[model samples]
Target: MKIQNKRLFASILFVLISVLCVAQGPPYPGGGPPGPPGFPIDGGILMGVGVALFYGVKKILGNK
Candidate 1:
């Protein structure tokens, strides 16, 4: 096929695909689907950061 023919075919195919994509209907009345529950880190993240900072400080202040 010629280059113009190929481009026309591609444009038609793209339009059809976009129509399907945009036809997903309206959103759920109840504010869409629910996401995963929140993860409880408590003090684990802070503890890790604290330990890393302590190690870094110790290394920086150490004598050669």
Candidate 2:
């Protein structure tokens, strides 16, 4: 029980940190995405980071 709680807490913390880091980080080095002028470079990069983190967390949880 304690271990499970710890794992849950750690996972939540990891996600929060990942989000904050991505949100506060610099914009993408290159110009914005191609189609329809997608989101701004910074927004695009942050979204990409968020998606990556989401998948990463999913993989980690699924594996265990």
Which number leads on lDDT? 1
Candidate 2 Cα lDDT to native: 0.85
Candidate 2 Cα deviation (angstroms), residue 1:
6.8
Candidate 2 off by > 4 Å: 25-64
RMSD (Cα, Å) of candidate 1?
8.8
TM-score of every prediction relative to native: 0.42, 0.39
Which candidate has the top score in TM-score? 1
> lDDT of all predictions, in order shown?
0.89, 0.85
lDDT of 1 by residue, 1-64 (tens): 9999999999999999999988887576775776658887779899999999999999989954
Candidate 1: count of backbone clashes, pairs at least 3 residues apart or interchain: 0
Q: After superposition, how far is residue 35 of candidate 1 from its true place, in Å?
A: 4.3
- Supply every candidate's count of residue pairs whose N, Cα or C atoms clash at under 3 angstroms: 0, 0
| Candidate 1 residue spans exceeding 4 A from truth | 26-64
Could you give candidate 2's per-residue lDDT for residues 29-49 as a string of tens digits?
565544565546678898999
Report the Cα lDDT for residue 41, model 1: 70
Give the range of the ten consecutive residues with the poorest summed lDDT in model 2: 25-34
